[model samples]
Target: MTAVVSLVEHAPARAFPLPDTVGRALAASKILEEAAPDSYERGMWRLRAGSKVGVVAVAVPGGETVTVRITPKVPVARLFFLLGYSSDPAGWRDGMVDVAEHSELLPALAHAVERQTDRALRRGLLQGYRTVEEASLVVRGRIREAEQIRRRFGMPLPAEVAYDEFTTDIAENRILRAAVDRLLILPGVPQTVRTRLMRQRARLADITPLVRGQVIPAWRPTRLNTRYHQALHLAQVVLDGASAENLPGGLRMDGFLFDMNRVYEDFVCAALREALRPYGGRSALQAKDVHLDECDSVRLRPDFVWYADSGTPRIVADAKYKAGKRRGYPNEDLYQMLAYCTAFGLPEGHLVYAKGSAPHTSHRVRRAGTVLHQHALDLDRQPEALLAEIRELTRRMVAGVKGRI
Candidate 1:
């Protein structure tokens, strides 16, 4: 059950130096801090540290007096807290090799996706997709498969198989190189990580628990030896269908963003499709790059769009990658979402931001005589918990809009 929050209300309790989750984790981890809390609650939560190096500040009454604040040193558990991975997997970390990975998009493009993927994956498989159009998922699947083999196997084959034998395996598509390359090209797959994962997989697979020199994984039998086992399950499914016939996959996935946008008539709704699922909604990614005057023209791309279960109301939300400062919301963001809500004929809209900042705050704005909300998704939260938060917010927003009308 969720506590209903009114856009009209505000919290006057000042704030704290730490996020509640981080504060709790610190206590649970039970590690003594090297020092005391640099930050205590002042009129504004103050810390004498971050962003730009040199000391800079003076605080007065207005929000105009911005102070340079310090970012606290990240505790060990906090890293896992943000990435949605298991922090204390017990021995799993030892078994789970930290595969050096990278995304293939330019920084701006990739960051745009961070929140999109975060939302969709959290929401559930495809609950966020507007339609089952085509997707380049086949490409992703194919590459993931080859890479898994390499992770399981590895390159520079244990002096057991010579370079010639390895080349033959890769050339014959035993590991499938073309699919690997295509996977790397996915709009969001990181290239550098793909490179390292691929190299490691190829070099390591040839001499594990097999014969006098016949590496057992050569045939890749199922086994349970971290010292010798491989993570090929997902990759294998990918390889199962990698033909011209499968090329239709990317189109469906690619169009998913579009369907979500149309379903609710939201603006350039730029979503990863996965993040919208938990809310029983769909998402899309949009752009105004089509026209040149678009420089001044706002290319407002939203992340998630919702159509009511009874199909009466629709909502649009754009997920922001960064947290906001205490004073107010990012004007550019508010402007963009405003455009989305206006274009979609929606009375309300949302701007959802990642929530790993010192203190997370939700800002509810009144735009065009309707309430527009900015939500903060806690990066430190468990995946299921985050999904629930988004779901409840959607339900409330729809109902709120109806009440306003």
Candidate 2:
């Protein structure tokens, strides 16, 4: 049995009692903290869902019958879809159908993993052997009997061989297999999905179990490796959500935290760059075009910079994941954009917000020629519609630039 705790977005903290075994797990994981002196429960947790929505789980002890589940008020499917954009924008559509059909985050993730694994299996897992040089009777690469003799004389024979061979037990396969293994144990995973995941894991028998804190090796992009990239990416996301701890049992997860702020920023920047391709202008993310001070010690990094044909900064844009005009557009953001415009010698800048009362608005500096345009994206909308909105914004940016030119 699991303890399902419902928390309203940005609401006051709520208390819940846990079994001693489970309580120990939560404390070790820090998923829940002690409430004030007045509250009687073992721990209190508050959910700050803000404008983004999704589900994350807390792992408990073996004997304990309680599990902590945090559910967001927003549609879980939509949230997962938006979250997917953070990791993959171009290929997100590849998983949206399954994402919208699943009600929980973990299942949706499972579906993604299964599909990617199937695709990878069809294409064939990349093979590359990690090199090893050892003293052996059989000669593989070369013999270093002299060094072996220097260190210690072998009783029978002495030879050192360094070689590389083909293997299916690479990091890519191990990571995918590990994620599948973890999902199989998670509650609320669909039986059908579990069956599919089990099959996928079986195919990766040669790969070793990914130990906790093991660094996944990076793979180069080739025809063989490219097919595994998306699958590997999704696997990494699932693996990162699971944290290991020393508690009543060997290791268990506390939960996963998805930072919607970073997700929105990455999506917006990537979408804008793609949208601007038709206009023949290049968009640079985290463009370091300006230094705030004379010493160049302090520098300004605008989220995006659109460069004109002549190789000059035409426009700058920033992504903000907040609500309404009051909270979304702050003095700090305005000041930062003003600095970007002044430094780049541009008269216009763009700010993309998560949600706003109006679709668009413009702000002009009190004593300057710069104008900041604010735009909003409703995350609840379909993924395709969201991309279309970005495309429209790009058109507006291009038109504005042309008029000035």
By lDDT, the best candidate is 2
Please give the CA lDDT of all the candidate structures. Answer: 0.35, 0.69
RMSD of each: 20.3, 4.5
Which tens-of-lDDT digit does each residue in 1-405 have in candidate 2? 566655443344555554444545545443433323224433443222343223434455454444444454346666666556766666666344355377666677788789878888885667877766787778787666677667657644656566775788777778888888878877667898899989898888778897767776665546667778778877877776665455555435544444556667878888898888877767789886478667777689989888987887887899987655544466677788888788778899988988766667789888886898888887777778888988988889888888999
Taking all chains together, the TM-score of candidate 2 against the true structure is 0.79
Positional deviation of residue 158's Cα in model 2 after best superposition, in angstroms: 5.5
Model 1 per-residue lDDT tens digits across residues 1-405 = 111111100112223344333233323321211212335442222122111111112222222222221222222132222221221112223213222232211211222223222232232222111112122323221233354345536443222211112122321122223323323333334555455445533533441221222211223322322221122222221232221111121211110010111222221122223334545643334432222233546444455556555554376667665335656557787777766766667777777665533343344455356456766655455444644565565566656656765
lDDT minimum window of 10 residues, candidate 1: 252-261
The positional error of residue 8 in candidate 2, measured at the CA in angstroms, is 5.5
Candidate 1 off by > 4 Å: 1-281, 287-299, 307-313, 356-367, 401-405
Output candidate 2 Cα RMSD.
4.5
